[model samples]
Target chain A: MEVIALKKLKVFLAIASSALILGGCGLGNLSSRPSSNNGTQLTGHANNSNYQSVIKHGHYLTSKSRGVDVQQDANQLNLKSFENGLLDLSKKEFPTNKYIFQEGQHISTKTTEHWLDRKSQNSQGLNPSGKETKVPLYLQQMDEQDFLTQHGKHLKLSGMTVGLGINSIYYYKKKKYGPTYKKSISNATVKAEGHKIGAKVLARLRRKPGLKHIPIVIGLYRQGSDDSLVGGNFFAYSVNKGSSIDGWKPIDERNYVFPSNSGDKGKHANDANDFSNFKSRVQNFFPNLSGVTAQAHYINGSLSGMHVNITTQFYSQTEIIAFTQYLQTAAKKYLPSGMPIDITVKSTEGVQSFLARKSGSKSFSAHVFNSY
Target chain B: MEVIALKKLKVFLAIASSALILGGCGLGNLSSRPSSNNGTQLTGHANNSNYQSVIKHGHYLTSKSRGVDVQQDANQLNLKSFENGLLDLSKKEFPTNKYIFQEGQHISTKTTEHWLDRKSQNSQGLNPSGKETKVPLYLQQMDEQDFLTQHGKHLKLSGMTVGLGINSIYYYKKKKYGPTYKKSISNATVKAEGHKIGAKVLARLRRKPGLKHIPIVIGLYRQGSDDSLVGGNFFAYSVNKGSSIDGWKPIDERNYVFPSNSGDKGKHANDANDFSNFKSRVQNFFPNLSGVTAQAHYINGSLSGMHVNITTQFYSQTEIIAFTQYLQTAAKKYLPSGMPIDITVKSTEGVQSFLARKSGSKSFSAHVFNSY
Candidate 1:
């Protein structure tokens, strides 16, 4: 069952986000099913020929226990329908999660924007500057397979996962923008949240029982900015009839996030400036000031908040206020949008804190920092 | 605290193998330690700032019970020495397994040749003919960490793992050969063997416990052939003093073979050909001829033996003998050497089996397949 092994590799690679696209290597195709040299589907592989090593490795449950047909061809035949059924079932189970097919789904502008927001939140670090592309990602059916071995006496185990492709989102984003759209968030958070959502999906899918003894697995996958499946996370569910949905045991889930698309632009282009860069940028405003330091807090990838400390030889309260105002304006000029910036101005007498950020409108807001 | 999250991510990324090298990414460097702005290492991190999220995620144990210095810098200071100690300890324990260091160790030419032989066996498909760089990877102390929470009143658990960078092997093969090499062994088998050795190492480490309640974990890692580390298998160990080493519980181990390397040259070259490809290659040699199929058995990464089934349309005994001889030569041509290749030329009349492999010296031997 090299195919089974490939299936496992595919799953693992998909989950590990950083796995190179297994294509282009002379090692044959890994993403799709293993094909014969002549390009024909291996429809009639001998029993366990494709899975013997995997079985020996104890990664898959055998069909020997029951009269189940775990043949690849047979499974492939039902894979689509089963996945669709699972997707529909998932939608029915957790509609708030916004599950949908990568194709054949129409969403509202609000829904798209919400996904964009989540996507932005998921991203971290600096992104290329361009037009903002607002792409919506939704849940869609993905690959499935039987388990390495049977469950209990009458139970058979099979599982499938889902993916969130950004192809359509990219299309939407590109269409909304001119050539490209600045992805608001960093690439790192998208991966972290993708894995979380995947596990969450798996936990949710555990409750749905279309087949007896076959435990279901659910996960989240996202296409890289390149439209390749670069990020995914998955979990397997063990069934318990008497227990609640939460009682289902989740198998090992990958914690790593896959890389996003290469060409994908982000909304926050200046995200490259972290604590260090911000410190220097702030220093540029006060060239002669010797003691100036900045600490930026990155929640996902973007700066959520920052603390800038500056020491001056001497300054009165009014002078400090004026300097703080000028600094607020200057800080706003360089910092990424929506981030809270706190400035600590220190004198020989005392230290004062100024909090600066965007107000409800386009105006900037600055005030004295309070303990609360 | 978020730095701790970054630390966990770094550890997980490093451990997962296939996890993208978080280098150059805006997500912050994860593998070593987190340095502050101006490239100065952040020394005075707040309590729980490094381990809070990891503890919340239940990934590591806090050193609350015993006075264990679980801080990254302290741990790092001991990392190289600790790893060296473990490697020496492992070598002393499992002499037959032949563990060597990537550097700073002298071994005999025989040992180097033995490793080269094993390395050749581990490699399959088309190995470009060239000078072989025989590097014997010895036991070296590797990444270690404190365990996930304390086990009991006195037991403070800690563990370590080793990685064999197959990047060199992949490079040697790619330079000597073309794009592909026959990967005779299954990823599953490689994974199984890796865990077995990992457990063996753990068992050996358990014998030298300086502390009664301190449990040690051991495992192996290989960067994927694509150097993406997408294919990584790992196992965790839980120690009990009274029980036999085998009795020790092994946490779940991944059953995926880390790819050799990919086009990233030594780092990203796709290494996908395994036992399945060998089987397929053998199968392809007899595609049009019905009843002509072969089964190749691999141990670790070498071909141990093969079972070839041949059905005759019309052939004499002499013809059968020639076909068997040709098949053996072809098998030898593709499969890793020093292993036996068995061919069973069958017909409706009777079955004739032939086994071919290298003999004591330059001679090759052939015999009828027998039970003995």
Candidate 2:
């Protein structure tokens, strides 16, 4: 349910670009921070309590960092993917049942702001400076989430994650309210700069007494532009050893917008066709459909999940229920297996029905909203 | 507008009871608070940047208190009305152009917790002492908003508003996993106790150094039960001078669920018939509608706004556009004048279209969501 709620928060866009990294929070000057006890903190949560709450988001204390991501990124989809994708990756290391999670407290807001700026005489920024057209500061924003372990009455920090949001296209102006120029960041350059920044980040962070030895997982994310339909993806990440990251693991995550003529769907041609068949089946079953669309996800060029959205002309709960039931049949017949897929039905009024099928589930579960 | 966004945040309920108060934040132990510079602060905004951002909702600095009300009051609709209605009432006195608003920062969480508890054992709650069901605590939660004015480069607190959320029905359990009992709070008791609590709150708040001389507006709110279809409303509020709330003004706010069989229709019979006629016209024009419903808001027993939701069975955008046009005509012919009304058209997918017309506007403006 939280997955769907978070999905609603992202702005619907068209397909764009991506690249990657993921990491969490580490130790900080504990006394300088505000009390972290404002929200409901949980330890050893029930196995089935996977739902997200502000205090504990599936074993992570989220610190209510919901809206700040878009401040620099300017793309809602990029913000969602950057935040949620990093969490998904963090789970591989910090198992929900084995460890507790909290928002990054060690990395101060000032630190992130300073890190994003281009290096200058007055500031120590991560991005290379004095070459505006050459370097063009790719790093936009950074977020940290800390993993902790229970030690008596206190939860001791064990590991952390760091997400680096890089710009796919840089926009700048020579004067205030003047015409803005754009520069596209190539995949090769993004990878190079992102790695350079990550290495420097590790070296600087290692000097802090609290962060000296703890491993840090850094993720490099290439952001989508404001008009982009698809959110950016994590391209590369490195699981560290002591103060050094031995190697960067290539994270090949891709998205295909359904009903596309985009030629890049080479290996994913079958997945695209399957999505097309699913859309047609649902549309054929309900001829009154206004429009049907989907954004399919793939990992290493293999299908993983599909999120479908349908907008309708009617405001009927009974119709929504019947259509959703029919959709489950179409999805089972035409969609990929081994991962969860979801569909949302809507009319001019609002969300009418939601259907989702988990990987292990045989059938889809549906919810039809009551309209009074 | 923020009005509709706030409405969506509320859970759809089936007529609920309500009551009132409204206020804002003032000065605190200034030095101890976190830096309020995290958000994009605006001093004198444009004539119309009415859309809501996390840092600012309309002219108010929201402090991201979006999901906290349900912590104390389980009903989501009550949370929306309790927060938004307080701002609406405060706007009458504060006026957006002259004063800027921010979330209540002065009343610490600890203060509100102590204030809401039933008076006893290390608690100085406003609610009276242990009499069990005979004197159940009515006070649920309190929120404040601060209004500020620019004084050269500095912004000074000009005044404040406070909102009191009261329980309409109290539910409690004696032991863990035990049967829960409900106690109904009568209007007479709600009024007497609310007034008494309001006066005491003023007396206590005036003692704080930062609050002594400033004017305060308090709105008393009655929260609806979880299953109620309609949101709660503010029943009464008072404008204070110095330490005293001069005289309370009864805010006669009411909501009517259309096509109800409940005999309370009386004088509203004609208005009800008008609504039914409008529904019939739309249904006759488009036989595929799933359902049409309206929540008519009245101030001083006169219709001020009608939020109509029509769910449809068709997923056709063309049909939605045409039906919305037909709806505009029907609305103009049947609905009351001098107040803004909005209609949302949705199916199971999500919001398909939104149609709204300001009070002075003669026709409704429509938006059809892009299905892709």
Candidate 3:
């Protein structure tokens, strides 16, 4: 009886040990089991052991690993291997390095620019100056799609300005100045009117959709030997986004100190030597305008910042009627809901109010509906 | 004299020992030293003794000094340290793996039928039963791009023989197959009048300076009804660099097999049951066309591949000429230099001859050129 009991006990113990081992192996129906950091048992052919090992190794490196070892591994992997491993690791970890990869770094701008310059220099094996020719075939190939695909997302069109110029003038004499003096004065006024015309032409671009986004810059320079401001020339372009604009902030004392003329010896210049104070002031009136700064210098005459000023003048009676009708038609076409057109004339003196009514005929004239 | 000599010998030995010890320290002169697996050493900052010791201890699980125990240090460093160390070692041994990271893995299909089925099912929010109202949008997009970009690179037409019904026969006998049919048949006959059309077309494509290098592929499909052949359709496209006839071989087979329906009952029948004979003939003529395989079947018709056969024969000759001309003109305009046009044609007696001429003048027929 004693021998039988001992044999039974041994058998029971053996079975219990076997069960424990199986449980540890995760094959037994037990709740508690050791988790493997690198290896685990799974059922079926779908459980790819090699793939699991790779995943486990990757996890081990990223979470429990240090940067020093990672750097070492990065060094160890060949270009292809490192790229593959990084890609695999990234999938299980970050999944995408787009956030980490610097934008615009993949495109080598210097190389592209250099190639463009070389092509330009060759001028399709034509003359050195590349003048009086059709656009380069290579450039023609660079349609909107090519530009957009290559640089659209990375491009930031900031701080750009346009330049204005005039070659001739028109003028009217004022009765306040005497008749004998009026002749010489009228001549000067005519020349200045030409420059004003140029300025007005440039100003009209503000209404054009494509040009509206670009800041208009004005610079006054002599074209031949004209004393009138109307005969001056101007130039323009956008400022690079990387530069600081704190100096060009609109403030009382520094209002006239536009940041232009980048390549000029004068202060606040643009690289192209085209930016000026007049351009900056006109650009400022545009509500949507941003990133405009300029520099200015007197070419053939002296004009202090105070003397160089702009005054908003009111429309004449004839002009008022034409503009009112134009506005009404435009409003009707663009604004179906309706809009308000306030015709107020502002001058250096003060403000005047009048009601502008459209004449029914094609040739319309404006009469003062009311006066104030 | 003996004492002086002993002193000199001792000094020399001391200097040699010091040099060996300094070299073993791993902190060589920074300015002239080469970069290690870790990184480049900065000038005047070569005293990286601590870093070197840590790296060595991490790698070997032992200390550099004779008496120091490093097992505890190794344990404290953990998996991160091991990973970093391993990475460093790898970098020293394998540098190429650093840049080429894997983006991701994808399950790709060699044939379009599975893609179409899966796509259709997905679009309808249910598993497809082999019959769908229309091809999926994504499939359409792919097909559009393939048609445009891979024109001459793969077969793009289907062929079949049509039996005229009694009513249709009477209509054709009276009105010459109606106005559209009359115009189309005349155009086809005119285009196919000379055998040199193919060669001239090839030469014209070669003459295109911009398309000198592009590889052209022409796909041919036969029209048949009850195993009786009719007219054929030919289309062309170009391939991008590095992709060759090898890449499109399967597509050609798929094109013929999927577009016809004759052998639907044999034990070897598959989705491509209809055009088995056509495919075999295609393979025979253009052995390299083995890769141009596709699987097609008719869902509603009593006979497989029957609809395509009737459609091909129903179209008039003028329509075929117009279609071929459109494809050739597109190729002439867009492809690069040196591209060959792959031509596929189907006829009642197989592709005996086909004619094509440049639009406007019958004098310049493609059949007159024979460099092929």
TM per candidate, chain B: 0.26, 0.79, 0.18
User: lDDT of all the models against the reference?
Assistant: 0.31, 0.61, 0.21
Using DockQ as the yardstick, the better of models 1 and 2 is: 2
Docking class of 3: incorrect
Error of 1 at B101 (Å): 26
- Per-chain TM-score of chain A in candidate 3 equals 0.17
As a TM-score, model 3 comes out at: 0.13
lDDT of 3 by residue, B345-370 (tens): 33331221122222233221111000
Query: Model 2 chain B: which ten-residue window has the lowest total lDDT?
Result: B3-12
Order of quality (lDDT): 2, 1, 3
Report the lDDT of model 1 for residue A279: 50
Model 2, runs deviating above 4 Å:
A1-372, B1-40, B43-72, B131-134, B174-180
Report the lDDT of model 2 for residue B348.
63
C-alpha lDDT (0 to 100) for residue B100 of candidate 2: 58
Q: Pick the candidate with the highest lDDT.
A: 2
Q: Write the per-residue lDDT of candidate 1 for residues A1-372, one digit (tens) a residue.
A: 223222212111121231112222232223433422222111111122112111111112111211111111111212222332234333433331222111111222233233333334534111222434433233222333332222221112233223332111233335643564434333455444444444443444444454334334342333323222112222233222322233433323221111212343442224433334545544433333457654433323544444456777533222233345445544554555565555556654334434444322333444321110
- Using lDDT as the yardstick, the better of models 1 and 2 is 2
lDDT of 2 by residue, B1-372 (tens): 110112111111111221111112232211111222221223222132121111222122323222234244555556555666677787788887667555565677677767776776335778778755466768876777777665543445678788887778877767767886789889888888888888888878888767887788888887777667566778899999867679999999876677655565565666778888777756644546888878777788777777788888764333444455445545665666677877878776546666677778876655444321
| Candidate 1 TM-score, C-alpha based | 0.21
Question: Which candidate number would show the highest DockQ if scored against the true structure?
Answer: 2
lDDT, candidate 1, B1-372, per-residue tens: 111223212222222221112222233433333322212111111122111112111112111211111111112212222332233333333331221111111222233233223334544111222344433222212333332222221112233222221221132234545553423334444445445445444444445443234433343433223332122222233333321334423323222222222332321122234433444543443332345444433334333343445565423222233334334434444444564444445554334334344322222333221100
